[model samples]
Target: MLRRTLAAVAAAALAFVAPVQAQAPAAAPVEIQFWHGLPQPLGGLLEKIVSDFNASQARYKVVPTFRGSYAETMVGAVAAFRSSSAPHIVQMFEVGTGTMMAAGRAIRPVHELLASTGVNIDFADYLPPVRGYYQAADGRQMSMPFNSSTAVMFYNKDMFQRAGLDPNAPPKTWAEVEAAARKLKEAGIACPMTTSWPAWIQVEQTLAIHNQPLATQANGFRGMNAEMRLGGALMVRHMQNLVEWQRQGLFRYGGRDSAADGLFPSGECAMAFASSGLRARVMREARFQWGTAMLPYYNDVAGAPRNSIIGGASFWVMNKGPNAGETGGRSAAEWRGVAEFFRYIASPEVDAKWHQDTGYVPVRRASYELTRRAGYYAANPGADVAIESLLRGGAATDNSRGIRLGGYVEIRTIIQEEMEKAFQAGQSAQQAMQAADTRANAVLRNFERQNARAAQ
Candidate 1:
């Protein structure tokens, strides 16, 4: 009788516990924070990508936060790192490559992170120039190239017709470009030509496309002690041309960075030298027909049409510290989540869509092929100009490969400042470039001093 009573009591207890267990809520998904700098539709698209990833799996949730412009975003990230509150992933512009690479213990290299998390993304699968820009000296990829772009010529076809110029035959040489600009001016165009990213389009890309080095030691790729060589013959000639054009009212000096991007779409400027990524914005805002072509080159230079270097930013993963039960470094679960998110974004479908939607060149070979096979490039004429320009010479030379200089952001500012002074203050182009070279070298030396331990 005593055994039977005990059995009944145990069975009742088990039944009550099972009901309570069944009513318990499931564990919350891991939240992975991603910080980036792209604005507007790009940021919205990125968020949608995160949403899709979250919907695809229940174990992870990625939240994308747009910090600001590229420069602001980088500054914010640095501050966050100092405070030990950095996000899992941060988008950094290409010029900031050296800074990110030298940030020892603050970054977790993409290669190392992927390996630790058992994610297999072959760096070889990415475009050569895209992958090459973010690689360390040993060729290990340091970050993930996301929005890769190259400088290209965007011109108003209607304006060309108005100027009695051939709309289809865009200018291919600097001489031809000058002639066209003059014709447009004669046709009563207020702003015959303008360029965004003066330092990048007029200086850096000019050097790269002409197969010239922006700095010594293979543009700082070989070592950190490289010095500026901007006051060279070619740079002087180009700067002088720009100054002359400005004086003749044939070219308008757009503000720094992408401030001049609007002049083209608003139909004020007939021609623009800007990032190929501007295609999307131009397509959206322009009421008249527009076309794109490779950037005009100096035909007299040897290998005059060498490949242009990439301009857009890449995604850098951050490291907090060693994990201490979630209070320090990223946990293994978080790393897995990040790796999964990267794999999702890098897949052919996602990458190709991103390239198509944002006008960014496809970073991965598979993505490019997939888009081409789908007839995307054919449907969107001139869309392939960026990739073509990047692959112009078949092989990247030391000068045309890519710039990897430290403190290049500040150096670019110095270039723009000197160029402005040359345009407005009556300073000779030669003198301005010489000043730029001197000031920029000081920044490089300071960066070298700060990162001396990296060399060791």
Candidate 2:
């Protein structure tokens, strides 16, 4: 009886093993981790996207992890790379392009990945300015653009009316902005004007709007041998104007980047310069009527009204760990999944929805057309200002594509410090600007040397 029972069990095992050995094995689900920096509402939105993708496909699972602010997230990604446990995808800010590109063998260029996977992604479909910033000199896209934003003017309609200014008309030039600020201040407004990201608004945008080069080598688009040229007449003059306005009480200097966005939304400031990304927050928090306008420009500059630069981030794919093998030389299945995800995010419908919800400019021209057809701009008023500003010109110059400096965060801090000393400590604008140029150039040189050694 015992022998018969053992024989029955052995036969059952043999039957199962024979079938398993003869048949093809089921493919294991590929898991890809996405590390991002968006918090709160944005973070939740990203999670929803990931959830939808997971539900739509069984072959791959995308897991998203919030890794804090942009700087913290970047540092964390670097540490993870060291441990060979980095996420497959990372959301890096625009400033980190130089650093990411410099990290050899760490990242796989987006265009190369798509091509290897046989995905037909047309880079031409992307807006010029958006593509220009993310592309290499040879016109290869290094990463995928996700959240993009340009600087714009946000004004209080109620305040404009109170000052007897036309709510429908906003200042188009620096001179007009000054005139409006003076009127608003005289009308009993405590803070007639303020701005967020002074380094970006006052310096970076200043260069782009004035059609002036911020650095010698087209704002470091060429290489790290670039030097700061922001001490030019245009930049100095603009800084001086701000200093004078601060003294006249027409302009209130707010704490560093994005901290003063709340002041404008709260009705404390009549007008403010901020990123287009602030649209959702402003719409939600602002009690009074507000309007958006193109950034003010210097009338004297030849191409005074050039397009502004972008401030948001992009998704960089890191080649690390065991998962890298899954991408292979040309995994059609995996490539299709990635291309589909990009298409979903960049599709006209999705772009329009994102724009309506977050106030970010739609990346595709078709998305803008769809939004216009839906009368979103007409219903929301100032909603069209950002798009108009972005499309004011045909194509972006090297300068208009924006700065790509290494150690850009430190450079921006140096710029902020010098400007603060000039505006708050009563230092001369020329002196402050010259000092900033020197300091920034030192940082550039240091980064160049460090990267050069890394290359060797």
lDDT of each: 0.88, 0.81
Off by over 4 Å in 1: 1-25, 321-328, 454-456
What C-alpha RMSD separates each model from the true structure? 8.6, 7.7
Candidate 2 local accuracy as lDDT?
Answer: 0.81
TM-score of each: 0.91, 0.90
Q: Which lDDT tens digits does candidate 2 get at residues 303-412?
A: 77887888888888776642234333223444445555665676677778777877778777888889999999889887877777776666888788878788888988
After superposition, the stretches of candidate 2 with alpha carbons farther than 4 Å from their true spots are: 1-28, 321-340, 453-456
Tell me the tens digit of each residue's lDDT in model 1 across 44-155. 9888888999999877788899999999999998888887788999999999998888887778889988897799887788877888889886789899889899999999
Clashes of each: 0, 0
